[model samples]
Target: MATAAPTPNRTPPALRRKRRKELATAVGFLSPWLIGFCVFFAYPLISTVYFSLTHYDGFNPPSYVGFKNYDYVVTKFPFFWQAVRNTAWLVAVMVTLRTVFGIGIGLLITKIKTGAGFFRTAFYLPYLAPPVAATIAFAFLLNPGTGPVNHLLGQLGLPQPGWFNDPNWSKPSLVLLGLWGIGDLMVIFMAALLDVPTEQYEAASLDGASPFQKFRFVTLPNIRPIIMFAVITGIIQTLQYYTQAIIAGQVASGVVGNSGQQFEPGFPDGSTWTVPQLVYNIGFQRFDYGSACVVSILLFVVAMACTALLMRRRAGLMGED
Candidate 1:
């Protein structure tokens, strides 16, 4: 007996309604992020790009000037090269130091037996601290005199090094300070270390390999991707560094703009004005919106080029495998 023409297979209305409901629910969950991206990132990105090609005073309509802004940054602007040099120094050195320090810390902490948990939390605390508060703390910590760091050195009969005060050491001091809040990097490295199999270590030991040999061959290869990840992200983070440099820059000049006097060049003898800060000063402080837009577009191109080169290099390396 043929089963009554088994009902032509189709989704029931109830199931169709449920699927639609699920999609709607998923979209609802993403609504906040979607709204934020559209309003903040998407809009601002388009607007800034448009503004960069124009001469816009906040009060006036933006006037298009073709590549004049970019030309000015590349050709006429003196501080443009200075800002590039400073930003490159910070990004290159800090990214390198952060990667090395984070990996070293992760390895050492893992080596500990009984106190790893406590030390991990303690070391990671800086990353959790509000950036402004942490920077202020660093400011006090690096004060040439009266600060605890300097006071302790004096107790040891050593000269208190100028950290934030002397322009000569300010960039280096900032790089060192950057290491303090590198818990995020350390944590990422720690996870990669954990992914390494104990059996692989045992096997390497069986071959009578030294600890460094095992690390060099097995551990390093295993963790290369993680290290590359850190490098890319570190580049992005350090390139975006502003709060520290801005504070440091403003302090260096020790001058504020007024009706009577022009604002000084940069912080602490103009040693710490990274590209973004330079753009801000030119645009707002100097009232040369045209130069600011040029500086900004150049900065955008530099950042993009740096990121693309890094990512493309990585892609090539991966493809070779």
Candidate 2:
């Protein structure tokens, strides 16, 4: 065989041409997404990373500062830690409450025998409201003075705590607003609950499992994946929570639009300053794009880490299943 000089294995010209054409077709189909990803996502991410290392205002050329931005954000920024705390509270308390309320509503809806469609529609309508409008409406409704809710509380001889205006109640007000718009999560949970095998429930029932036992052992296990999904998404959403919090703060502070003055975010003693709001304030308001990018990078990292952790835990749970 060595003496004979082994011939090279090669495709026929026709086959080669066909393969090339197939590859071209595949590339053609993928080109749009590839171009979009590079232009939009990849470029922005790279720019952000670079900007985070530099001192750049929007107009001036970016000058490299070598982690000074990060240092400032970590050590010197007054509102940075407060914003992180507020965001963490939203991620922890708000997300958990939304998930619980969503699941509870979903279960209740699934158990309803009459006017199911009506109830579903009624519940979902709030989620359809524009975030800005909803925040404004909620803020007005809970206004400490001259709001209908306070008026009602006064009539009932109950303490009317300032909802959005009070520092202690501001985040809770946002949580309530979030819970009011949990129709999307409710729908997801309802679908997942319905998809669980009825046979599993029947088996648990036949085994003398009580209603709570069936729910715990059968229903929960079956819908665990969906719950994980909802929780993870809720976490991510709460991490980027900006619009509602900002609007609520502005409404409560009586600053509707640009008043030609520096609009301080996180009104009522900085109780509602979120990371995204901090980023906006830094980048646009103060023109400290570098520090803004640092905050954004931190946010991105936190969101990715939380999502990965949840996903890994979900995978482990699924393996156990």
Candidate 3:
């Protein structure tokens, strides 16, 4: 009676074989994505993280410098703090304004009974324009002295502030440019609005909810995820803001120097020099690749943190508690 010891339960050979086959099939399906992940994203991220710790110009071999690169970015880079402040402002203002206006415009277009298609197309056309061309065009139009916008403002007896020329107005002019191309976000909002169940509106109507109540409780809650998506993407894009800002800066500064001449970015007193511009100036302009990598790494960390925070809030918005 004392000698009886039971053996652990074991899976049957046939069942184990079936499970293995199932796993193999799943892996087969995931192979492409797995390969891509390792080859592209994983490899590049690892390389960047490693390079960020070393002093490596493009032509020379990398010299390991421990945390010195990070130290320089924090303590030595003159434009680092200004870039951070500008980027934060851009993210805050652009994301909020884009979300509000996109939703509002979507609602407006839906309310139109006739020529909805025409209005949608017209609004979306700006988003389709090449960013470089659009920025150049906007710079010309908003030119303080020669642009028609200033002339029209003058005729109407309104303040014709120097748009990109003055430090105070440069950021605002960039915000205006952003607003012009907000049609992509607006279209997404419109699609989300259209997908909201008509039954929900009817239910709210039967409950005698006011229009504000209906929108607040019905429309907004239903589309909260979409709004979150728009905000997060806008934040990411704002963090990487470069081309249009640079173009606007160059045009506004009127410093298109001779070929091979490097014009300083963040014109109008460093108002538009975002973090990406800082990276470009450090890495490409000055050829201090190490410091540039450090800044890039810092920006990457920030973008990841922002994305994670937003995604975590998404579950809460859906009443997941």
Candidate 4:
């Protein structure tokens, strides 16, 4: 038999020491992020968990209450349930509208052979606008009395809605405002659409597939993962809907004061009130940190449940693939 190959020499101690030094250097570089995580994320999360179980206002010592806050939120807080219903409605409607419009716009853009860059920029520029600025601008444009939108609608003899002022029209106005920012999702969908294999398209064409058939059978399936990503993220975002609603509530409620001023949020009889708004009202306005923490934990649980459900669906899809 051939002589056994010489065993590899053990790593020299110097090399091992050098590796250890490099590892230390790498860790040193990561120290800031690691420290930030522990301080900001870990500490706050742990504290929230602890405080959610106790009654703690900002100034007073935390009183160990043991689920009373949660019970109160579940049973006594009337607005809490309304916030839940409103948030659920927002999540359902926003996610569906964003997905449909985002994909539709993306598909349309991809079919353009000329000035595609211009069209892409035009479509995506809205997403680049600051959220607050965009919401303020939309508030102006949708103003019930003096807005240009209603003026034009009047010229066309259409019913001019009381957008932010009227309770019935408030949520729909927010939905319309959300659609203006669908550009982000559109860009993602465009990327996914462009990534569909041309070979599949060719095969479908050879099989005499119509455009709709090709899209339904090939394009949609290929881009399903991207759509799912957009939907899940959209769901999470809708659950946390706050800034736009608050700004809309403030501006439309005819309270043109400093944004910092303590105005009742979710105006029009609390029609625009959401869970995050409720949490803010509890924590900062009422100084009920314990109840706020409880609400925060509940939101966290809902988000985690949604994420888990999506992950399970993703696992099933992957298995099928």
- Best lDDT goes to which candidate? 2
Best by TM-score: 2
lDDT string, candidate 1, 102-206, tens digits = 999999888889999998998899999887677667877777866799899999998888877787888998897799998998899999998998899999999
Worst 10 residues of 3 by lDDT: 253-262
TM-score of 3: 0.93
Among all windows of ten consecutive residues in candidate 2, which has the lowest summed lDDT? 254-263
**What lDDT does each candidate get?**
0.80, 0.94, 0.91, 0.92
TM-score, every prediction = 0.82, 0.94, 0.93, 0.89
- Stronger candidate by lDDT (1 vs 3): 3
Model 3 segments more than 4 A misplaced: 4-24, 256-258
Q: Write the per-residue lDDT of candidate 2 for residues 1-321, one digit (tens) a residue.
A: 358878999789999999999999999999999999999999999999999999999898999999999999999999999999999998999989998999899999999999999999999999999999999999988999989999999999999999988999999999999999999999999999999899998898889999999889988988888889899989899999999998998888888876775679999899999999989999999999999999999999999999999899888877887
Q: What TM-score does candidate 4 reach?
A: 0.89
At residue 212, give the lDDT of candidate 2. 96
lDDT of 1: 0.80
Give the CA lDDT, 0 to 100, for residue 59 in model 2.
95
lDDT of 3 by residue, 1-321 (tens): 588789989999999999999999999999999999999989988888888899988999999999998998998888999999999999999889988989999999988999999999999999999999999999999999999999999999999999999999999899999999989998999999999999999999999999999889999988888999999899999999999999999888876544676789999899998999998999999988888888888999999999999998887756762
Number of backbone clashes in candidate 4 = 0
